[model samples]
Target: MTVGRVGKEILEEADFNKFRQALIEELVRKISRGGCYGADIRQIIEETLREEEFVNFANKLAKIIEKRTNISKESSNEAACQLVEEEIADDIKGILHGQLEERKGKSKKEKEIDFMGRESKLWDETTKRFIGKKHGLKDIALILKEHRLMKITIVTGFILLIISAFLFNSIYKAIVVGLTLTIFSGDSLRIKLANVLGGLGGILIFFTSISILLQYALLEERRSMELKEMARDYLEKAKRKENFN
Candidate 1:
């Protein structure tokens, strides 16, 4: 199935209205960043029109000119406000300025910036626990024991599992690493570290899985037995596990 997008709906026309909408979109971006409300955007648009067109019109042009599909009326206001702020026409006199749709999708650098915000939102959305949803002690304990129910320990345990996978050369270890990271992406580290760790943990899981499976397959039974015996031979190395980074 193809994913649908907005903003492109206005592309049917290649006129002044289109330029206004494009200008509005840029304005919207700036206003959004500053947390400016629609009123602020409208005020800016009004000032721009009054100065350039020699008229003080409200510029309700977005709502009037286009159907509000992906664009909100408030968003239109923001977009118009943003248009004037960026110096599109420099003077907005008789000269015409046209802004094309940059792309159907956000540029990769824009997407990267957007991704960090989304990743932040993911953390922010997880902040509070719902008390009523909390079950009894027995239920909680049983939930903790299940492989599928790793909502909490996965954070630190994921890192540990990564380290553990290298030591064991087992697919089980890699699966455990992935499962742990997924369960606790919202948690696990300071918010900043959590973002880095969450992404890294995902990468670690995939590569570690392949590394583990191949390492296991390559080792013959006799070699495996010898490795285990050799591991057991050293007391100091007993507790510390090797890393798979």
Candidate 2:
């Protein structure tokens, strides 16, 4: 209730639109400041209204405030802004509810700037910096990171290819597979689809490379067996020489 707006269902139920639509500006003030029983709210109301608007704002609030206490007059701008703050709360809820009803699928974040009491400039700068970074790749490291996320998932696959080669010792296969998979990276939909197809091709390339590596490993295994046999023959000859001695 203090932060969120009242939904359309409650606003319609309360019939506030039917009764208070004509008194929009006045209602907005009362709802914003949160009507209090003290002079604080009254002072804010008095300060906010002009000579002409005062008559209506006061007259309108008098009827509403009189429900609990007699309407108090405000003498300063500060008092008026505060009073308006309270007045706008209910009206804000009503307006928000109407918007929600109209836009059934979307929700909005509420932003209020209390310029009188806060440093708005600093916050504005920070927000701008954050938004800027999100929309574009500003720095080298970030660009590299972004490109890595492209449809081909270039960064991850490049890493994967490097790892496969280092362990398996096939530079050519690594280069081929890395290139095949890294083709799909871009900040676009069509590129993402292309990346998928490219990845399938890369997978085929990967399997072929694995097959080649397996054959190499088998050749190495056969060469190892031949070396073991030669070593055994030398050891047997050395054994015969020791037995004769």
Candidate 3:
């Protein structure tokens, strides 16, 4: 999926992230050149930390500083880590702010140029309103026509379904449904109705087959139980006769 343009430059997902990181690194390097310890730098860092976008960059920069300087991630060095984080964050914010301001200035200039070439029409407002009203009426007519077609399609599908269920076997019903769908499937409304009716028919057939199989299974189970009980009774009567003899 393509991400929309940021200013005049279009950026994909990967490129956007890379751009953000590069901007942050470049800003940090620029500030570091001016000597990393100053009141303005501290203020910038504090402001950058407040912005949500720079939080991850701040953390990563702090870790890099610790690694390079061999500082332990202990309570004693926590303040130092925070200072480093703030310094990087401040630079990133400054660079981003400058870029945003520059884009705004360019956008304003482009808009002014565009406006200069446009002619002012005295009756433009009335013309636009009339055109809009005409389009709206056309849209309403189209919507009504779509609804009427859908209703007709639904009625036809239902009639076919009822006829297939009563006059034919399951295979014939399936074939009828397929033929009816093929006949009416050109329009969007007809296609949707066909799909819905076909799905419902399939579900009903599945359940009907399952119910028949379940009934057969239950009947067989009952017959087996009855035979076992009869055998047990016969054995009891035979033993009684033997005892009596």
Candidate 4:
């Protein structure tokens, strides 16, 4: 979608309007309170803008834009940031500058320098939080647990264990290992050793199956992460290309 189209949609969003108004009102209240230095005022403004509700609104906007335009989330997020900077930040900076002027009556040169510095800082923080933030990767274990291949591997492994138990007659050995070592107390040393080795071999087969499955799961998860990063990078490049055009 064109930048103007996205901007128009952002302007029409009710939540965006509410967020913008609330931000301005909060900033005005905080700035009007006496005794805040310029830095303190900037900090207050930045902290307020970064509040959970405001950040959530930005995220929500980005998701909506992504869904509507079929744009990459990163590009949609940039669009969201642009909307916020244009619709909310300019008004905030204007109010702040006016407040500073009233409070200090500073020379124009001094006021201009301070204003530029604060503006730079605010934008830097906003850009970092809004556009540069990343979503956390899905939990590999949880994801793999529900994976079709992983489930098959687990069931197959269990079946192999049962088959091994029957083939090697290691069920008693397994019971001995699981419940009590004293099950074969009256047996000869050779018998005990044979049972132990047979049981261990069966267990090893099951564990080897599990290990292979885990390795496959990890590789799949890593590949998924790489694909996501590549997509984000592609989107970022596309955004840059769009801007250049």
Task: Judging by TM-score against the true structure, name the best candidate.
Answer: 4
TM-score of each: 0.19, 0.21, 0.27, 0.30
Q: Taking the tens digit of each residue's C-alpha lDDT, what string does model 4 give over 144-187?
A: 46566754655554554454345436666544442333334435
Off by over 4 Å in 3: 1-160, 163-184, 188-191
Please write out the lDDT profile of model 2 over residues 51-82, one tens digit for every residue.
47455554443333223222233322332233
- For candidate 1, the per-residue lDDT at 222 reads 31
TM-score of 4: 0.30
Q: What C-alpha lDDT does candidate 2 achieve relative to the native structure?
A: 0.37
Rank ordering of all candidates by TM-score, starting from the highest: 4, 3, 2, 1
C-alpha local distance difference test of each model = 0.35, 0.37, 0.37, 0.48
Candidate 2 ranges beyond 4 A from true positions: 1-197, 241-245
Give the least accurate 10-residue stretch of model 1, judged by summed lDDT. 122-131
Pairs that collide, model 4: none
Cα error, residue 149 of model 2, in Å, equals 34
User: Which structure is stronger by lDDT: 1 or 4?
Assistant: 4
Location of the lowest summed lDDT over 10 successive residues in candidate 3? 123-132
Worst 10 residues of 4 by lDDT: 125-134
TM-score of 1: 0.19
